[model samples]
Target: MSVPPAPALPVVGDGLLDRLLPSVATSLGVAGLARPGDRVLEPARRAVVVLVDGLGAELLARRGGHAPYLRGLAAAPGSRSVACGFPSTTATSMATFGTGRLAGEHGLVGYEAYDPATGRAFNELSWEDGPAPRAWQPHPTVFEAASAAGVEAVRVGPGFFDGSGLTEAALRGGRFVAASSLAQRVDATLAALRTRPRALVYLYWGDLDKVGHVHGCGSWQWGEELEAVDAELRRLAASLPPDCALHVTADHGMVDVAMDRRLDVAHEPDLAAGVAEVSGEPRSVQLHCLPGAVDDVLAAWRGRLGEDAVVVTRDEAVSAGWFGPVEDRVRPRIGEVVATMTGELAVGDSRRHRPELLALVGLHGSVTLDEVAVPWLCAPARRA
Candidate 1:
């Protein structure tokens, strides 16, 4: 007997995140943003979206023993996690989630985006009073609608993120509640929920991502962080008011890219030829080619990368619906060629940035299920 082939690539409408957006928007009472769904979460007084960074569906399942509470939630009915769009990184994924739009519409192309206007590669998440949020993201977040529709909207996270560029770009328009720890975030979320009859609280946790970046996804440190996240989720769920509901999800997942498998484009002269700039993480790369070098660039990369990655021309990705319906405005943000790693790796030029990026133990920014599938754990309304 032979094993069946893996399921087909996820379609735009069928992915987990696409289906959950409407339910979430409806529960929060934001009129137009939500898609159609059964309003199972009743009482609808308040809704919370707990975003756990790096907790992908596959990682949550394989590493569930470390996260008992979260695991239980996934096992429950009406609880599911879905794959995020291409280049499963936090910046792009969060923008997709906050806007209810695909990456193509939102223009948050990746973790390290080459801003077309500036022609510079910068970390969007680490922006510090440098760029204008509206100019950078140029998309209206769902929070904007929540605030306009008279729902009390709030963002609960670390004090450092009170006005970070990514927060403002993808999740601004809500009141910021600064908290230092998971417990504080939980307390903040509950307080925000009860402040008004219609409220939308967006809570964030970064422990899992932090641990996974430092230690591999299979490490003891990552496990401990998952346990802490699980405990916090359970605490938040139990403390919700009678009319409230909680939706726990994540930005992306993690995969351990062995150092030996990493292909350093800087070292590979053929792969680097005609390539103007390289952006994205170790697992995914967007290669911008010089004028009229697009074909040569693609052929060279496809020939060199071989089976280690999937090398698709920008048009191919756009036509294939990789980033949802590609918008004209987003075309420039995408490169002439996009390389998504499958079994091997794509490394950054350590000479270009910090050493820590190269040293990261766990990584993402690929289309693989391990990096794209995120869990959506919903807690039924307490008094419904």
Candidate 2:
């Protein structure tokens, strides 16, 4: 079977997080926030960036009827979709968002990456027993830069994230306000904004993404959850103080994989052969091949998976700009063989991942438009 050609690589400096956060920081007058001018957002005295997990631009356009508020925002002037970088998962995108850099510079390559220092698969999200967050990702976050510039930086999210390893790694600085519910988060963000004459507030909402993962992006549950998020966002936007601007975006979009399209490497001898470890999420898998087995592993996966996935060697991936100019130190963490799912197909290792993870209906990580493109919708605060 002939494998189809890979999609065009993400527009690194222009569309990805490398430009987004720096633009935000610059707009807020944060010192040491280095980057080119933003193509999406305008300057504001107060800005609130809301990262709604799993809210893909394509998904939103297709399901706009279910979210009137978001639909209006999408249709607003200057609203456009931006590409999240390769392996467009939360862990990778969050690091990209926080550090205002690509995976190569920030070193959070994937959801789960091979940590050469520990000889284990490091889970970027949980970070349990993994390397120290500061040491693992040393880049100063946009929040930290904003705080250093004397701009009040605030993060409003769930209580558990107040001091999580992921937070420490990506969003270390700032006043962390624990808000368990959407209403609480909105309230906390508003209060934080009021605390300072100029502020940069980061708000996170994960329920829609959770629902999409469990029930599939096509399910009514996903639609219902999106509706709830839309309603809450409507309230939040309406309540923002004058001179505050609200910017909405996401880590990545999701695709619902049919059971027939799901490939279990554990069952496929060719795919499992010479693979020392399987990391990354379902849509994009990182295969750590054994010594002298790189060619064999590559051939096995390409021959077996064919057009259902794009199989590329690490060098090819780097050449293709997947991780965007990988650093020398970060190069080792990438898999020797990387496989990115295409269309509706997903590859997973049931033996390595949790049953719940493998069972997720909606998944994202690949470079497909449905997974990589997210909206950059902005609504400036209305004066009373």
Per-residue accuracy of model 1 over 232-328 as CA lDDT, tens digit each: 8888888888777778888888888778877677688898889888877678888888999888888887788788778887777777777777778
Cα lDDT of model 2 by residue, 52-136, tens digit: 9999999999999999999999998866788888889998899888888888778888889888987689788888777888988
Against the hidden reference, what TM-scores do the models get?
0.93, 0.95
Deviation of model 2 at 37, angstroms? 5.1
- Best of the candidates, lDDT: 2
Off by over 4 Å in 1: 1-8, 11-22, 36-43, 128-131
> Model 1 Cα RMSD, Å?
4.1
Model 2, stretches more than 4 Å misplaced? Answer: 1-7, 10-14, 381-384
